[model samples]
Target chain A: MKAQKFWPWLIVTLGAAYFLIPLLATFIFSLRMRRNEYTFDAYVSVFSDPKFYATFGYSLSVGVFTIIVGIFVVVPAVYFVRLRMPWLRPFMEFVTLLPLVIPALVLVYGYVRLYGSSSLIPFTGSILGTDILLTCAYVMLAMPYMYRAVDNGMRTIDIGTLTEAAQIMGASQVQIIGNIILPNILVAILSGAFLTFAIVIGEFTIASLLNRPAFGPYLVGIGTNRAYEPAALAIISFIITWGAMGMINVLGRFAPRTSARTD
Target chain B: MPAFLEVQNLVKSFGTNTVVKGVNFAFAKGEFISLLGPSGCGKTTILRMIAGFERPTSGTIRVDGEDITHLKPNQRQLGMVFQAYALFPNMTVGENIAFGLKVAGMPAEQRRARVDEMLKLIGLLGFDKRYPYEMSGGQQQRVALARAIAPKPRLLLLDEPLSALDAKIRVSLREEIRAIQRDLGITTVFVTHDQEEAMSISDRIVVMNSGNIEQLGAAHDIYNRPATRFVATFVGQLNTLPAGVLAGTPGERAIRPELISLAPRPETDLTLTGTIADLHFLGSVQRLRVDIGGTLVNIDTFNNQTSPLQRGDTVTLHLAQKDLLTLGA
Candidate 1:
């Protein structure tokens, strides 16, 4: 009995150490920029660089844009499939999973080939068009996560009766979606949004191929020439991902609790 | 004058299967009627048609002389309480009750006052701020009721609203619902499969089977004078005896177990000899299965302080001639 309890705790401690050690090592390495002493020189050097602010800001804006486009595309498509065209659910699910099945590198390659400068819709012709193309690609890459989250959220509530009840109350279709459906699924949407933010912030393939100075390309550029500053950048990227996940956990508590109590 | 709610030649079919086969019924204003049937009997389908949730393949549903057959659910001005107590999880009790009023563009102050009135009507006066998750199922159902009726809809529909609750709460809440319906005097169409629930609350019970209404009458008439073999067997517990055994013409005879007695009495018109096959004590009454002439007949008698009859004992059972109902196949 003692061994049974001890084994689980030992395994959990080992797993925690396995994850935390890399982060700890990177943090200590980032502080060793000043010769023979620990200091915040690497962090200061990275923070003072104008490219750092420009690239990070660009990535943040792209992340937000990707989330907005993803919500507009996924929420209504999933909602309509669930409410009006339930027979098409399997097809929609299969489409969403295609992103996960087709890797990001291959997808970016297809975008380059199909939307090249000579194509009819030359999305890669101009820098602005390429950015838009990159944003669309990120939305596709995040499709599996976003769709599953919203679908699971929809499963918890009875969309049929809720829609009927709302209609009986004289709410228009837009009002029903805005006031009733959106609020009920806010947590799921936020969870998907945060996951998308984490995924797009340091994405490498599409942004690099598109020649955009996103944070992922910046981190790679630094890794080639600078040693301690790369470690500093890694620490910053880790914090951003950690912060997004933390926000999801905090906001999740506020979502409406399912009333399963029969007391 | 036209009836308040009239459904004419209502029919519904899904794919190749016909669920409701041209049902027709009407009710006056302020009438509490129940559509009672087993599952797949299309009772709920009929109720949904009336609520404008399901479009009837062929029918005309008129409310106060207005043809609402093709109207949308919002235009129907009908309220519905679902079997699952579908209270919106995001809203508080007061907000849920005020949803219809808010959507109708009622002013805020008036909406608040109306919501308070509905909350008081449902006996949840101080529960305006509580979310549905914090409340019990019975409480949530009351909130759902409040939310449905706050708009003062032209008609109210309850689809087995009490089927999910416990026995005690089901009984008490059903009575509360009946009392509220009486006080409001709103026309109501309730759907349920439980016969006792229908008999206890409805002014008229429409017993349906296989997409057709078997019988429609008051509780007493439906129970005492069932019009069909399906109605006789489905509405209550019944024992079927061969026509030859009852000395009747050439059809099956149906009799209620409670109508039979062990001892002969002045009102008794038919007598039979049988041996007791089994006895089941059911709190206030005892049910006995007797083998009479190779046929089994069940009889229910009040449980008295005297020692009960034992199994395998030969006994004489009595039944009035009027109690034996002859049914056609």
Candidate 2:
């Protein structure tokens, strides 16, 4: 009859296990060197290899690139649609969420068909070709998360009031967007950044299709070459992603309450 | 001589139904006017139109002889306070009050001084560092008031500012608002559903119903001589009876509860015999409901000079002819 007594603890325990199991399994796999030997050999094998550092370094660069590009592309686009062209919201939202419905691998295949060297656009022939392809794919894959975050953020404040207030004060449209609107929605932008980082770092299909040396492809390459090292790489990528997200959550704890709504 | 703010034949229709139908009024400089009506009346729509938030279907709004009907809310140079206070939750009290000045690109020192002046005016000088959530409802409203008046706009519009507050705070804040408006000598238009609030604070009250102005006059005149049946009932309590029996036309008689007195005197022009249906003791005053024929008429009498009348006693109701408003059928 007293549901409150048992339900909360039960739900928390189950939720913790749901998230912790994968982490624990990864840790256990990383620790095992042999059937009987429990050592740091896998970690050692990973750290000593010259290629592991290069691959992880490439992954880090690509993830950071993806987040920066995503922020630049998404914030203004979503703000424009939400504020000026609200009539196109349903169409824009559907287009952004289309990536979620299409599998990442299938989407990457489409990107290759559209922009790869042998495809219609032949976009990879340019000087910035490979990184460009990788960045485009990352932005596409990470769009759903970023758009939703920014849209939700924009919804919290009185957009009309903020814009009107700034405009009447002699602020141009660009200044209003940059100074007032963007700063107000900084938290959402940061959350979107963190999410984009997580997605791009873990993504494998787009990089493999485009022949880009991103972290996901690098991990897979190392996995086939060295068994224990792949586990270590997986652990490293997991830590990077988890650490970034955890930092976001912790920073979010001390964030102003208005951050959830405005910035 | 043109009025400071002029609205001519304003109309606003949502879909098929018109919320504000051909309403018009004007206000001179330093005049305090109240648009008094019940909920669903077009008082707020009219206010919004004047503030340039809503575009009228057909009309013109002129401020100081300049047409501003198509201007934006910000371009009209008017400050408005919403019913919910609408204080920016992210800003401190000082920042919230200084928002207009900050927008206006005032120098920091001048802006700071103006913020301080507004805070002192609202009696919240020490609350500058506080955020909106940290303050009580009354304090938050004072901050909102300070914010609106800080800009020193040509006209100040208040939309039910005191309705959100408790009774004691509402009275005090209303008095403070009236005092500040007087001190500033700014033209003002306040919208309220509360008749008491309008009557107590406004120099003139515009009583509206179904998107039309029922009566517009000085507060005392509006209260004393309500032009229509609805105005009589809406502005104050009234005793409505058939015209033949109630001394008025068939519609209603807007009679103040305080205006009708009870006595055994036969010299009164309006007299009726009825049983005392109920008696209520309201501290200094006693309320008696007398049943005359089938209609119940209420009367208020001072309790200090006489012993309280017991319920179920037959009493004679006496009313002055000048105190009752007779409406056209």
Candidate achieving the largest lDDT = 1
List candidate 1 segments past 4 Å from native.
A1-18, A101-131, B247-251, B263-266, B303-308
TM-score, predicted candidate 1 vs. hidden true structure: 0.93
Name the TM-score of candidate 2.
Answer: 0.87
Candidate 1 per-residue C-alpha lDDT over B21-107 given as tens digits, one digit per residue, 9 for 90 to 100: 999998989899999999999999999999888999998999887999999988888888999888888999899999999998999
What are the TM values for chain B, all candidates?
A: 0.96, 0.94
Model 2 residue B74 CA deviation in Å = 2.6
DockQ of every predicted complex: 0.68, 0.26
Which 10 consecutive positions of candidate 2 chain A have the poorest summed lDDT? A254-263
Clashes of each: 0, 5
Where model 2 places Cα greater than 4 Å from the true spot, the runs are A1-22, A32-41, A44-93, A116-122, A127-133, A154-185, A254-263, B246-254, B264-268
Q: Give per-residue lDDT, candidate 2, residue A98.
A: 86
Backbone clashes in model 2, listed as residue pairs = A184-A262, A184-A263, A185-A263, A186-A263, A187-A263
Judge the docking of candidate 1 as incorrect, acceptable, medium or high. Answer: medium
- TM-scores for all candidates? 0.93, 0.87
Per residue, candidate 2 scores C-alpha lDDT tens digits across A73-116 of 88888878877799999998899998889997887777667876
